[model samples]
Target: MAMDFSNAALPAHYGLHFTPTFHSKIPPNIDPTSTTLPNPFIVVVTGAGKGLGYHISLAYASAGCSGLAISSRTSSDLDALASEISKIAEKRGTKIEVLKVVADVQSDSDVSNLEKEVRQKWGRVDVMIANAGVISKYVEAPSSSGSNLPRGIVQDADWARVLDINLNGVWRVSKAFVPLLSESKDGPQALISSCSMAAHSTISELTPIAYNVSKVAGMRLMECVANDHGEEGVQAFALHPGAVVTPQTKNHAGGQWSDILADDEGLAGAFCVWLTKEKREWLSGRYVSCNWNVKELEAKKDEIVKGNLLKYRMVV
Candidate 1:
């Protein structure tokens, strides 16, 4: 059935109501069967050279999946990560492949080359993670920054750079890989989105306007992709990885370790373990936090899906 959520109300904490049809009704902590884990799947992660991307790629590699790590400006870091994964895979006697590629997601030609390379190496890709992004600095121009910028204030090239990498880059990668994902006979492919809690909360102290806006747009992008391809087995999810200690967060904010541990560390770990579990079909197109609150969020799935579809039309 077509999912619809035209009249649902958002939770009080989010300040907006978004209810939808086609709820999963799955328990938050329910575990998937062993056969459902995406092992031996070929996965690709952008910005996988460092930070959260590095750790996430490692997690997948440790789980016995072949991973391709890409970066725009950090070939050395990407190489190191690939090498480390190779070592771990060899020690475990599990056949996991790690390929490191240097391509700027903002450049159409670069991303095109990346697609070509992956296709040549692997016939099909089962998973993709669009995780590359940036933040704003305080040393550039006002007009070049964004529409909300105030007069006489220098916003810096970093502002536009962030949007280019966070938004346009994602578009480039997803567009290039959709065909490959659709070719999979097992079913549609999966996309893991690195979204943020800032999108739902107004904690100005915790988030800057530019970062929040980009992340919100990112989550909606995943929803739209899911709506378009879910019928064919291509599913996407927007995930808030919580406060993992990454260079991106540390560059703009502080308290990396403390922020992550403030919540349940085991819960987050369990969620990661669940990510690769089989029966992931039950979790497709959902926005997941630390704990697998799929059922609670299902009530709003329809509205979220519709809003994302509308936003996609505007962009196109």
Candidate 2:
């Protein structure tokens, strides 16, 4: 599928009364100073061992966040990332505490234990980035093969594995952490998402049904959290961090797609940093790409709600 980065069309639901002029003055990268604003905020980043998670952790560190808890399946990778961030903080003359936890996001016990540790260390958490995800072979393939499993033909084991970490895992972590975030005087919970172009476009051949379903499920989770907790000062956002050239994508790409993935990594990383900034609240519960805020997509809010209801029904 061809990717278009231009900002030309706006969905009618955005309630955009006027066509805003595109400005070249928008900073190409996130200003580190914006992250250091008052109120020491504690952040927890899942899947922080590599890829977008690694960069997101650094963004928080640059902002002088109080402390960060990094979690991934591999302890060594998490420790290495924490060590690098520690050095960066030291050079900046800021104290950013780093905690490494090895946990499989798929397991309830793991999520529970990680939450307990964080609550013990810091009574409150300001940000929770539910970023851990796995793209199984079904979703990672370049195209569907004749012998390939049916679309959405997720095996019992694959279903368990994907939903466990992608959907249920996020729920477990979010539910566990909400109490801590609620304790905070100021509340902001950001849930990071990958590109949801599949949700918007019919690319079943290029994208797997399971992966699309998982991401769409993820977006709804954020919305439900926002609706339930917004009045309490907790705001939730679902962010599409663009395409980043990561090890996972590298293993999935076949031909030209490989080059596209490689080129998008840095741009995507920069965009994720910018999206985490304070100004992104405007794009809450909506799909975003290439720094383009798809607030118009918010019109389908009811559909998102319905999708969540159906998913819960199936799970229950």
Candidate 3:
């Protein structure tokens, strides 16, 4: 669990947060109905060995994305994913020029080389998904089965490692790919930051402090990319993929709550594909929840734009 706005002590800026007074939902002015996104998108998904990244790559493949590049630390995982995508392409009737790269997101040279591979092969990277991240190590197991759970105190190494892979890794990926994204001329281009709801709220007892803090900073990074490059026609978004079980969860031998409400990984992937579609400049530099009905958000577009909702700020 993440933060609770009503109870937890927050930053000074959050104290001035206020809900805007609005009469009704207004239609968004942008007419996306006519704008067509490029099929077979030129995509680069880091951390594509498994979990969310793998699903996202499959989503792109099924969507007829032609130029696809996936990176991972494990060559075997990448090999398997490449084979799967090939089968998908064979059946789906689209040519997928895919490349599986072995690169560590933590290394600058490794990330740079990954970007170079994509650019050298396809010329431009239309969508860059920064999905490489890590979770905290288990500090202690709960003693009782049905009693209240005590928060585990994180060690310094645990904190540092999580931040290194989850936060700095994302920065490395974006830095390597943004230039290629800016160079694209075909259709909409985006830098997708794989964020967590932990950024908004967390139960200190249940969540990793490092993971939560990194996501908060990650969201801010998306805003910086948007503000710095909006005029250059680059779109960026920090997305909260709903609670879904990952390999880490499986390894942790998850509790009863793991069986509770959770979204399929595919849902996040589909949302990402849709986000890269045309006329979505209004959403740049913002944080989005994948569970929100896209059409509903569209209907209130005017209100969202005018009110400047869905952002962290200092004043009303």
Leading candidate by TM-score? 3
Tens digit of per-residue lDDT, candidate 3, span 1-316: 4422331354433311222221111113212222233764688999899998998888787777777899999999999999999998898666888898999998999999998889888888789999988777654554333212334443423777778888899999988888888888666779999987655545543445777788888999999999998887888899876556777444433344444225676767777777786648888898876655677667767877897766767655
- Please give the range of 10 consecutive residues that has the lowest summed lDDT in model 1: 1-10
lDDT string, candidate 1, 1-316, tens digits = 1112121322333322222222122234533212133554777888777666776676566556654545545889887887888886786677776666888888999888878887888878777777787655533332322222222213333456767888888888889887888786473387777776546643332444566667788878877787797777777777766555456644332223243323332233234445534435555666666433545455555655566321323323
> Least accurate stretch of 10 residues (summed lDDT) in model 2?
17-26
TM-score head-to-head 2 vs 3, winner? 3
**Model 1: residues >4 Å from true position, as ranges?**
1-39, 67-72, 138-157, 203-205, 251-273, 291-316
Candidate 3 ranges with C-alpha deviation above 4 Å: 1-40, 143-157, 252-256, 314-316
Report, for every candidate in turn, its global Cα lDDT versus the true structure. 0.60, 0.61, 0.73
TM-score for candidate 1, residues paired by index:
0.72
Per-residue lDDT for 1-316 in model 2, tens only? 4333222343333222221322112233344545453456678888889887787777777667778899999989998998888987897788887778898888888988888888888777777878787664533333333212224454313655666677777888878877676677554555454534434433443445566677778877877876786656565666556545665555544434543353333344344545554534445555544434323333544655565321222223
Of 1 and 2, the candidate ahead on lDDT is 2
Worst 10 residues of 3 by lDDT: 22-31
What's the ranking of the predictions by lDDT, best on top?
Answer: 3, 2, 1
Model number with the top lDDT: 3
Q: Give the backbone clash total of model 1.
A: 12
Q: Which regions in candidate 2 have their CA more than 4 angstroms from the true location?
A: 1-29, 33-35, 138-157, 187-195, 262-282, 293-316
- How should the candidates be ordered by TM-score, best one leading? 3, 2, 1
